[model samples]
Target chain A: MNIVENFDLFAPRLINKKELLSGGHRACSGCGEVLAVRLMCKALGENTVIASATGCMEIVTSMYPTTAWEVPWIHVAFENAAAVASGVEAGLKALRRKGKIADCDIKVVGMAGDGGTMDIGMQALSGAMERGHDMLFVCFDNEAYMNTGIQRSSGTPMGASTTTAPAGKVSMGQKTWKKNMAEIMVAHNVPYVATACPSYPLDFIRKVEKAKKVKGPSYIHCFSVCPTGWRCPSDQTISLGRLAVETGIFPLYEVENGKYKLSAEMPKKLRPIKEYYKSQGRYRHLGEDEIKMIQDRVNKEYKKLLNKVQCLEAWS
Target chain B: MAKRVGMEVALAVAEAVGQCNIDMAAVYPITPQSHIGEHLSDLVADGKIDAEFVTVESEHSAISAIIGASGTGARVYTATSSQGLMLMHEILPIASAMRLPLVMGIANRAVSGPLNILNDHSDIMPQRDSGWISIFVENGQEAIDVSIQAFKIAEHKDVNLPVCVNIDGFQLTHMVEPVEFPDQELVDKFLPPRVPFASLHPSNPVTMGAFAMSDYFTEILKAKDEALKNSKKTILAVWDEWAKMFGRTYKPVETYKADGAEILLLTMGSMGETAEIAIDELRAKGMAVGLVKLRLWRPFPFAEIKEVLKKAKKVLVTDRAVSFGGPGGPVCGEIKAALYNEAERPAIYSYIIGLGGRDVTVGDFTSMIDKVNREEVNTDTYEFLGVRE
Candidate 1:
């Protein structure tokens, strides 16, 4: 609340108007991840270079002849965005100090999807954070491997049926919970870590700006709704993102220098998990018992988050 | 002044790289390459060089880091061997195709199966088609010289490709031989600051490593191929400039006593020196034998290879790595491909020898020649010399 209290979100306001991620990107309609990237780019401003991992963001934006990115962007591989960003940050720092390039501090940012961040790219992200590079890594979580088609990823929720983890007679869907990537990054002792959703545009913008200014490594795990992958209505993409956050399934919070705090707009009373799951077709097969199980888990996670906020214990 | 001193080959190679004024180096150490990395890190830590030394978690991350650094217009370097090189294999072609002018060193070692960590070409053989301009070193002096020269060749405006200088593990890397390090002043004059062809900077925005569909994939790949092929010109020019400055000459394909000889033994890496000794002994006994060393691996040096084998009646190509089921040895297969369809080509004999660091002494070289003399060795496949069975 303290971080968000100073800003007038609607006034002659703060967020840069420059669209660093230009139009003509090939992202599918009702894609919340692209919108999140667009918001992130707005906060990152012009003095930034991005290293994108291979996924929807990379493929949709960069297609050889034409690129949607207006900033200096590079797509290296599937899982090394953080590693590449580390090198870019180090390179720029060395170049500036040695007088090779103009002396200026440029923010280096890494972008990846759920599959890239939670699974294959986890090691690289951990390494970058451990090395304490001055960079920000953003994982756009769409719950599944959306770009490769709606297959199960580590970020896929339990009881959600995917192509790979489809609900069969003898088996339930994606049998495990979504990975807690934000906490994993926090465990690396990075300077900043946050969970954001594009539906809360102002809160997300503030987090991005904060991450951009972090002196050491920072990470933002963005929960972006995938209408295509989740088998939901395209028009409800924004609403679904908001519902997830409101229901405490994906709480908007930040761990700044190891101190946890809830975002100002975090609902005083959490909505039921059933309301969050009702919008998507992936969880259609869940019975009353499955819904109750998910509800209890969400409540328990929310309570745990509240406890952290109360402690305000910054790691020494 | 060009200073000469006795130094371990890996440390000498690191010393040479330190003088090149690189901005960053990402290293993940493996056997034989650990010294090169440790020394480079010490150079940065001790303030001997102003560079970012990244000790990455894995070789995959190490290569990826350099690729990122090079994209931002930084002169970058890295070193790996054996499984480390195997880990980096996926990212190697990406660096080249991105046209990042970074340099790397390969302490050539055998890829493990029986878990050997000594000298061989198995690690680098599979990476030949990765589009990196590779150079093989014969000894410590050449290792140091070529390591320095690799930067110039990679950053050349016309070339703009990643280059890897291959020094045979232990054979060259562990040897304490005298090396002459080119003066920093002269090196600065010879190899100037990198002027990136295209860089990632806020002032000039660009998207690199874009996804290409079928329509543009082949054309993009072909362009990368041509850039690598045409890079030979810049490689020659850079090596020529190095020769003039340092007074130590180098060639794409170097020969030792092959002039008017009936049998020319082809070799690579540090084995060239030992093979030369064998050639001398054979020549003393009135045997017309000589040696041709392949210095440049990629951009193949097709003409130089053909030229060296022009008049020789028999070409004994020694390979340190097997191609398995196909071609036998990768090096010999390359040589055979180079000499294919020649008008009066020499009878090329493929002898797979000294794999996994089974020491190829002068005796092994003489025995290979003796076998070639008694019978027409099979041209279709390679014969492993001194197989225990």
Candidate 2:
């Protein structure tokens, strides 16, 4: 479908205009993570239940009686969101089997921040995937532990300024490179795994729709920018996300089973990594050599991902 | 008519689970309790039972898988011991709060630090407040009998909470005894199909385990508390129904020969049988002592315990579990709390004993009662029984 036609056909059909994520949320104004969640909920529609971990999304939305969520939601401990959602999905299925529930399409979604996804919740997530449960696992990658005061997470980009990986004279920011979670998810050989960005709302919606159609486990790794944590202007959330994809720092792709398809392939002449980095204050302290080091690492990782995708396509 | 057969407590539990026609079992092998899962898996594989047996990686996943399977409105069962029980601790509350009638066999063993995998109540004691109904079986026969009863109690509409059937690890689980296996037809008649209050159904959809705000959180918690407390009567009713069919009686707290006794020895799990022998010797010596076996740990059996203790001048509470820094053991602390306001409450002395499968001889029980009489009940807590240097 053409861009306009695609928007006309898919946007309204998928968009859940009912704002489940209401305003007045304590989330920092223009929090990209919440926007991504808002858009995702809209795409998934109302017949859905969410299991959230103890993270920024959970803390900010569920403040006693004043909940931002309009949908039925559960906030279990940090590492057990996947496990809890597994229970919810199983409970729903059992009820269906017993004729307690009528035939209605329902979705179980798990939302976790980077730390919850790639670190603490990893085993539970792996187990859930291995079990082949019908559910969606969404990882809002803000790179650092924003809610817990910007600690380093596996999703934290190399040379990024986080509380645990602070920039100093002898060292750059985070020394470790960002973990390729989408690839890791694909390695699980699940039915679907896709990468998306909030900046590309239509693209993100498409991935959500695709994941919903998949029979078994699906993973969507959304590149969500944290304006407050990244030391960028609140309004720059969407623009930074766009810059990430355009600069080839966060390429969009989908892996269905073992097959790979690049969703948004940029031209060979991409924007400089510096353009993407310099926009945020997290990378402001990076010296010339450190910047080059980060750029080299990013280039190598991007090339590796591209090669893997290309090899898979060639074999298929 | 099914033929009666002698079976180990673990095997009897497995056979009962199969006979009950459980839909699914997620199990991880742990000492003592491992036979329950192993036997169940074999039964399922051999086509003796129609069920899904999931061999999980860890005790955490075993419980998590059972929670998932049970949530689906399928009858589910699993078994675990000491550290394994501790590992599944996180999922325990979830299972209960969701109102899933999940029945688990807990082979009671000491919790590890120095790593002992033998009999003790330390394991299941920590899980008392997690909202699961805990039933302690003193012998092999009771283990099998209570396991079947656990399903009925758990699935009862009034008592829709998970039930833990606690059998002392090697002492009960490994010991073979004469267990009357109820006919499958009789079991079917007594325990009907589980009608879950809520489940993962597409039609008539209702949210379970929804996040409650402070405005509604207290109400939900209060409801859970009320459900558990109100279930005491339902539990009694189920026991009565079970006894009528199986021809064996059960009580929340069973008083063994405690009529007008001056010294009351209170014990739980397999240690009660050992204490019974000691009680016989003490009674013969004119010590005026009797034994009270705590069959139900959760829902505490408070009123019955108070009633039984009223006739005794001194009560010796023997615990197979220790509560490190706390007064007495965990069970003793709970018993004290239950009896605190009673006007005629007897002098309660707590003794920590039989930890890590240490054999409890008749001498240990006799000496403990003698010490209780001679020493003026000086301390509310003492670990003098089987205390190692």
Residue lDDT tens for model 1, A135-229: 99999999999999899999999999999999889767999998898989889988899999999888899899999898989999999999999
**lDDT (0-100) at residue B68 of candidate 2?**
60
lDDT of 1 at B378: 72
Model 2 C-alpha lDDT per residue in residues A210-276, reported as the tens digit of each score: 8888888999999999998999999899899989998889988899988888785455666778999
Candidate 2 falls in which docking quality class? acceptable
- Model 1: native contacts recovered, as a fraction: 0.83
TM-score of chain B of 1: 0.98
For the predicted complex of model 2, DockQ is: 0.28
> Per-residue alpha-carbon lDDT of model 2 for B1-389, expressed as tens digits?
65667778888889988888677777888897899999998898898986666665678867766766565577888899999999988878877877879899988888988899888888887888898888888777777778888898898888889999988888888888886778888989988888877554333333444455678877877887888888889889988998888878999888877998988889988888778899898888887889998888887788888888876888888887777777868877877888889887788898888888888899989999998989745654476575558
List clashing residue pairs in candidate 1: none
After superposition, which runs of candidate 2 have C-alpha atoms over 4 Å from their true positions? A1-27, A45-49, A60-73, A89-108, A168-171, A265-267, B21-23, B46-52, B68-74, B94-100, B202-223, B374-381
Of candidate 1 chain A, the 10-residue stretch with the lowest lDDT total is A3-12
